[model samples]
Target: MSKITTLPLGFANALLVRDKGAILVDTGINANKKIYEELFRELDFNPRNINLIVVTHGHADHFANANELKEITGAPVLCHKEAVYALQTAGNSAIVPRNELGKSVFEIIKKNLPRSTKKVNPDIIVDSSFDLHPYGVAGKVVYTPGHTDCSLSIILESGDAIVGDMLVPSFFTGEPCVAYFANNEKALFASLQMVLQQASIFYGGHGGPFTKAEVLDLL
Candidate 1:
């Protein structure tokens, strides 16, 4: 059985996995490196065992320490092609230009980041949907854009979906707190509905490991 552990990376959580080897779903801010290390210690997992790193999106909080983590574990990073551009380019933000809401969130990340942070690209660039069988896992990548166009979700064979910043659960029904970040409202909604059709358990980038019913209630 594959074990998924949530490592609290402040307001967000980075998922850690234990199967044939370890896998990390995301990397939190570089400034929290020590805390992250400590968290690993508490979990009794050696960081070296993390063989693959999958970044759900390109946000700073979610990818700030990706390069460092990859170096430590010799793990290759995987992300959508859009996110690859964000990571390869040198700029104040990784978000695409012209997205008002995305810009706002990007600014927040820029304002809080350490001055010396750097960007890094993923080893595997996913242009569309891809399978994880080659990586020794029973999962596949679902290109669920609209959160940023770069946003993608992971669907395990067991029906667990790791949706990054796409459809967050809200306090109210049929509405998420924040839907699409990069001005792609239509795609975001479509992606949410698509995910619901597949997975019963929804693992969000911000607020959940929610059940299908709970996610449906919020959608």
Candidate 2:
């Protein structure tokens, strides 16, 4: 059986999936080295057993510590083909505001978002569905765009998904919503629909692990 553990990486939530080996999704922006080191000590999980590291998107918060984590675990990094440039350059794509609240959030992000210090060259890049069996996890990385042009979501055998930023909750209310900001609403909707058909629970980059019904209620 595979189990998912949520690593509270400051504002971002990175996930660890356990099976024959472990797969880490996302690397938090701040104090990552200490967080993972402590997590390993607490769980007694051998970092060497981590085979793959998946970056949900190119945002600094999501991939900032990717380099640090790679050094800690000796695992290969995986991300969408579209996200390769951003990762390699420690750059980011333009994020469009989806609503008034999104506009406010974007302004805050522009001012306070920390710069990514390390440039990470990806070992594996896929623009379509890719199986994780070779990486020791029973899941697949499915391309889900809209929050960003390069977003990806992981669909585990357990029907729980780490959806990157495909769905984001309200910053003020802490209520689950479709997304706070989206690059393309149409694409985001399509991706959500596809993911919902395969997964029952949704885990996002921030604030979730929301149920299918909870998500639908907000939608």
Candidate 3:
């Protein structure tokens, strides 16, 4: 069985998947390098034990420290092909709001967030689904494009999905629902439907660990 550990980094989060080897999902911001090191030590995991680093999307908050992590772990960085531009250029993708909250959040992200300085060229560029067996994990990286053109989610064999910004737990009510911002609402819904068919438990970049039933009720 794979163990998933959520490392909350300020406003963002990162996931550490441990099986025969370690797989890190997302890298938080550039300043998170020390946080990663501290967590690795607390978890009793050597940095060298990490075999792969998977960035769920091109967002700075999610992938800003990937380059540093690759250096520390000596692992290949993997991301969707479309994410190359944003990753290499250190630019953010345009966000489309889905509701009033989304609109407010989008404004804050646009106006306040600084562009990440870290630049990374993915070692593995996934076009669709990429199996994780070769990397010693019991899961696969599936393209879940809605939050961004390059958003990807990791679906574990145990039916847990690490969905980055695809869905978020509501701040006020803590209810599971579609994310506030998406690149395309229609595509986001389609991606959510696809995920529902495969995953029983949903983990989000914001707040979650929501059951399939909870998500279904929101939908």
Query: Backbone clashes per model, in order?
Result: 1, 0, 0
What are the per-residue Cα lDDT tens digits for candidate 2 across 1-219? 568888877778778899877899998676567778998889888887889999988887889878889999999999998889889888886678888988888888887765578899999999989999988888899999988889999999988989988777787887787876788889988999989999999888887889999877766
- Residue 119 shift from truth in candidate 2, angstroms: 0.8
Candidate structures ordered by lDDT, highest first: 2, 3, 1
- The residue pairs found clashing in candidate 3 are none
- Residue 70 lDDT in candidate 1: 77
What's model 2's overall lDDT?
Answer: 0.85
Q: Residue 7 of candidate 1: its Cα lDDT?
A: 73
Q: Give a tens-digit lDDT track for model 1, residues 1-219.
A: 456787766656678767666678877553355676788889888988887788887776677667678766788999888777667652222344234544655567555652226778779988778876666667778888776777878887777888876655442343444453544777877888988898887776666777888766655
Instruction: Give the range of the ten consecutive residues with the poorest summed lDDT in model 2.
Output: 27-36
* lDDT for predicted candidate 3 compared with the true structure: 0.84
lDDT scores in order: 0.70, 0.85, 0.84
Quick one: best TM-score, which candidate? 2
Off by over 4 Å in 1: 30-33, 90-116, 169-180
Clashes of 1: 1
Q: What's the TM-score of each model vs. the native?
A: 0.81, 0.96, 0.94
